[model samples]
Target: MGMHKDQRACRRVDCHDRPILSYGHMVRIAHVTDCYLPRTGGIETQVRALARHQAASGHEVSIITATPGVKRSGTEIVDGLAVTRITAKIPGDLPIHPRTRHHVAAALQENPVDVVHVHVGVISPFAWGAIRAAYQLKIPTVVTVHGIWGPLASPGYRLSELIAKWATWGITISAVSQVAAKTIERAVPTLGEVLVLPNGIDVQDWQLPVRQHDSSTLNLVTVMRLAPRKRTLPLLKIVKAAQERAGITMRIHLRLVGDGPERSRAESFVHQHGLKNLVSFTGRLDHAGIREIFAMSDVYVQPSVKESFGIAALEARAAGLPVIARSQTGTTQFIRDHQEGLLAQTDSGMASAIASLAADRALLAQLGEYNRSTAPEQSWPMVLARVDEAYARARHLD
Candidate 1:
């Protein structure tokens, strides 16, 4: 007699030839975040990368995000991952509404999932929902704290902290960075055991074509949102100082690619500093556009006083650009002093570093070479292995 499809016996051949069921068997992961594509930021990029990697590894992955506009609705497949954007009502002018949690919870109920990973921050309504759903279903949940919680000392922040403490696992993007990790741990003591997994980039995509050295112009680029906290004014000051102090008269061009609330302010500052010919602002470009910008540039600078993981810095290194970043935050962790790149102390110091590197082409090339060599360590393959191991520990499978 023929055996039923659902009632097939465990014969020797069937057991030996077929893949064995392990702990990671057909893992279905639901990534819940506040903002996603169509809205770009560090956390959005990181979650999207993780989802793509997970989907590529033969796991089913889906992302839930809040849709503010009428145009974005239903499911769409992006980069081999399924994305579902739900319609939310906005009572105020806020980009996201409180009802996002209800919509996300309903979606989770409709689609039973294995694990739910939450990216919690100031705007994480879906995170709140995902954690509550996971708790109700008794499924393992992981929370990645991507922002600084020190600014959130209000009642809302306290409530979010309570939810975070109950998470099965807490992951911080820059655990190796002492400043970032300590800041989070101080606010929420329960997050002391948080796993550290630095952000990563696709090294293959950033490979630049070898070009002959151009002696005429020194290309300087900074890829960041034109915001106040990023401190773009200081970067412009550095450019001015480089021109004045060096006296090299080498053509220095600054490419600023990103747009934000501070764009007008930055433009005014640039005008005030008479950097019209030297500085060019390319308002927010996609990854491919940014990659092209990186390829054309000789050096990358990040002057942000507040940075979590510095993914842009990693991308710059992958593209073989020598990076000079602020010495305060997560950027300092990735850049080794005088080895991979240089970390400047002040605006004057940053200007000095830029001037010194521009004067010496050989040193710039050497730093770029060293940075490219170190790119593999910050790739997604290495970062994901650490993430999987952390998930195993969170689920008590280890």
Candidate 2:
């Protein structure tokens, strides 16, 4: 069966007066992603949020993902959303599932979706397979780029983009940030028209009362996966350098949150520098746990130089904690330098910014207040409005 743009846009699907779309009719949207709830990352969070928002808007939403350890593959209802999980062996970061194409086809046939949105990445067997299946089924497809790309990652990413371009028809492409869109444009020059769909967070959950720090000891917090691109080890070394310079006059305590591939290396570096007294590693924590930590911290630090969208940093800002991040990253798009937080070019610069904030609590409070006021605009409703526009464009109605 083939899906098409509605001949006449409906003013209401059933009884509500809300127009289906400002430009098109309502659709049963199917989201295909490489990872989901069991896996924790920025992409997982955004996908889950978008699905919830779409369902809340009265659209039937279905999620198709790989079940890494499940013995059986089947449909399940998760928080009012329909999920079809396909059993597969996931080795390393990417899951290699040759059966994904068959699974996707079966799921779509059983569920019958109107729009297929594939969240694309470098090694996404399920996502790539879903895109091909949607094309074969003659369903409209949208590919949202979720992979981070740079000079180092470009070779493989360019290859993947070329393959994607050749594998599907009438596919609309979207990126999570302006930086990501530019990267896609550079990687696939022939694949014209990439939309920028920025990631969003639950602002209400992060709207905490301003944190209070000890007058003598300043608390620094960083919540990120301990990966190479995150620069967690280097960040710890920078903190050690700052503490060494501060000596007995200044006291600095760093609380590192989240666990990842580089955790062991970061821990070794901390031990090598004799920073056990200054740095505390709290492994992985849930949203509530992270919010509690944010409520206690004086400042949030983002060390990743290759972030497509700094969701964690944005969450910290919404919690009324001033951010200090690398100026070269996508975080700069949201957190203005010297306004909401300080952006630094180098490790030494970041250290200096942290030390300055610790010494001046009033300036930090002013920045936090400004961020809290502006952060609500990055909520799920704002994100879904843009997603609706993207869906309209995908249907060739916009």
Which candidate number has the best lDDT?
2
What lDDT does the true structure give each of the candidates?
0.70, 0.76
TM-score of each: 0.83, 0.88
What clash pairs does model 1 have?
A: none
Instruction: Report the C-alpha lDDT of model 1 over 1-398, residue by residue, as the tens digit.
Output: 12233223444223223322234444667888777886677788889988898778776789887644334667787776778877556665233545655666677666655567777664466566666666655555666666543464474367456645574333222243455666666656665555676677788888776666566677888888777767777778888887776675787778999888888888998898788877999998888899888878998888876676688887887788888877766776577778777888777887888888878888988998877666647778887777666556545564
**TM-score winner:** 2
Itemize residue pairs with steric clashes in candidate 2: none
Q: Model 1 scores what on Cα lDDT?
A: 0.70
lDDT of 2 at 73: 59
Off by over 4 Å in 1: 1-25, 69-80, 91-95, 99-102, 149-160, 167-179
The lowest-lDDT stretch of 10 consecutive residues in candidate 2 is: 11-20
**Against the true structure, what is every candidate's RMSD?**
5.7, 4.8
**Candidate 2 error regions (>4 Å):** 1-25, 69-71, 89-94, 163-168, 245-247
RMSD of 1: 5.7
